[model samples]
Target: MRHRLFEEGKATDCEEKIASLGRTPQEITQSLLNAEESLLNSLYECMRKDFELANGGGVSLPGYGTKGALALMAIYVAYKNGVGPFPKDLLDKLNEGRDSQHLRHIRREKGIRIAKHGRNEYHLEDLRLGKAFSNRHKGVEAATFAEIKAAYGYRCATCGAKEGELHHLPQYRESKEPVILHQGHMNPHEPLEAGNIIPQCQFCNRAYRNWVVFDRNGRVVGVSDWTFVLKSIRERYLRITEENRKIVQELISSLTTQLGQLGEGE
Candidate 1:
């Protein structure tokens, strides 16, 4: 089937850069695939459903046989390859009948918490609706959010950028020493407690995911930032030095033992 692959301004800078390397078409394709393995993997995940269906004697190339599917793939490929979302001019020109307002609504509800009281029980009139409980996952109570806002002046605790999502820091797990430290293990399943929650903007929270910072003594002190990276390097150097000291001591002991044996022989 003959189909147009890329549209004007749809080519990403990364793709252009790779193509500019004076490489063959095959080489460029391989480079793009290698650089954007994750994007390709997600696309593959979508393709897999069709693949399974086809195996069961369903429609051949089911997902790939449509224009919409092709458009989505092209857009995602460009976006993941460093081209921003589909150009505004092109989108306006196409007049694809896609509702911009509805898209905004979807974006607004990206991480919003829907109130659920009991298991499989979501009642709008329920008093517990929209209330952030200590055991809830998705969101915190309004009161908890207020406390966070009051603590940080309604700004992001990390960079003071914006009053964003309710990020759960490491939860409180009982340590052997019974000493409560500031940083703890980040358990995703843990309840949303005030002490374990922080107000973080989307940028800071999503930038470096699961990025744990360690202190000189190997304790997780903060997020992955310049300070954390510097401390990690310093910690690595100290560990190497400690290992070298042990090696040097062992070598000296071996030499001393050999010298004593030679003296006895003489």
Candidate 2:
């Protein structure tokens, strides 16, 4: 099944024009998450994930954050709007001060033919965005989910919360109760597989989503470079996770106290 496109009940995608320049993705994204958001900002998170946003380490990997963001948006906008090349002005707003023509250098340096225009417009290769914003996950079998849960000891790979719900074939269910063990993909860029799947608690899944990839050993093998726009959300995720961590600590302390009381009576 295809992943859900819209957040139910709440309408996003304001289509508000981003006329102002020098706006960071974090500011724009937080603004959207907090109140109403423009179309571009509303979808930045999804776009960030699909690009496999990593540090500009290798030649092929797009530069993390702003560089990747601008390129992906170019491809997405062109294909979606039937615009021949993604417009220059739109790309500019995604990252200000850097002239849009740098996309050509980006295309050359990355060794990927993202094809920038002489006039600074850009478009994705062959008119396809592949998986950006597509949210494609080949659904996992119920038994496989059970196995994954067993493998991970039914605990969240991120923050170990013992009792939680098990979710198979991730659809990113939002919950305030934090009652889910997500079957998460190991490589942020790769598709779901038995080898790559890991169990993460709801807090880990939601908070660390799109920003970090956990190895089978539950070690952080890779991290996405932060964009100015994304840093705030990242902070928000960690802040919430910290609060939950404290709650777990309190529970442990209370349980230990009870255990001591029981020993005293004995």
Candidate 3:
């Protein structure tokens, strides 16, 4: 049986791009999730093409298909978010893969939980939708969220994004660890601690999970390099915006020149 899931940092061919830019897997996923329209389109197109080629135009096989699945997911998301119409041809091929015997076997054998409202049918739109507020588990105290927001100056501490959510630095879902856990432990699940919480934009916050901090000596450690992480994120954000700015300026110049030529003709 074969099954696939789009885990972060496992997107098709994203590793080479990340390696070429000398970024951690975490950073690459974060950037892709938060990328501007032009960049996101480029990333999605590359992933889509790669997936098609890798899977031989969607010939399903009994293999772990994480890369191709994530590539399709990335493409689907870019199309769904007002970027463009859904690519029906690509979607059709994906549907074929979904109906493959291997996948059917996995679906029947594995207990894939489906929400009651969904009736075992998954919708792409559900990717970005938040869980129902009523169904949400207890999170950090409201007081703590406010305190963290105030401390971070109501901005994403890493990228300086003004609109961001309070994030537990190590994330809360890694284990069944209590919201408050012992400090000075390896990948300690310390949710709600002032020091363990940071402001992060929704995209960056959701890009990765089960995060672990490591030291130069390859030891699992708690969060400590705040200055370094923040500096890196800020630099990357500036770079992305700067590139987009150049593209926008070029587009405007081309349009204005074309309009001037049209006026001369008139």
Highest TM-score, which number?
2
Deviation in angstroms for 25 in model 1?
69
How many steric overlaps are in each model, in order?
A: 1, 3, 0
* Candidate 1 ranges with C-alpha deviation above 4 Å: 1-142, 164-190, 213-239, 242-266
For model 2, name the residue pairs that clash: 25-229, 26-229, 165-179
Which sequence of candidate numbers ranks them by TM-score, best first? 2, 1, 3
- By lDDT, the best candidate is 2
lDDT of 3 by residue, 96-151 (tens): 43432222222223321112212222222322222222211122233556665655
RMSD of each: 21.8, 19.6, 20.6
Ranking by lDDT: 2, 3, 1
lDDT of 2 by residue, 127-150 (tens): 212223111122223458778787
State the lDDT at 246 in candidate 1.
Answer: 85
Q: Which stretches of candidate 2 lie over 4 Å from their true place?
A: 1-143, 165-178, 225-266
Candidate 3 yields a Cα-based lDDT of 0.39
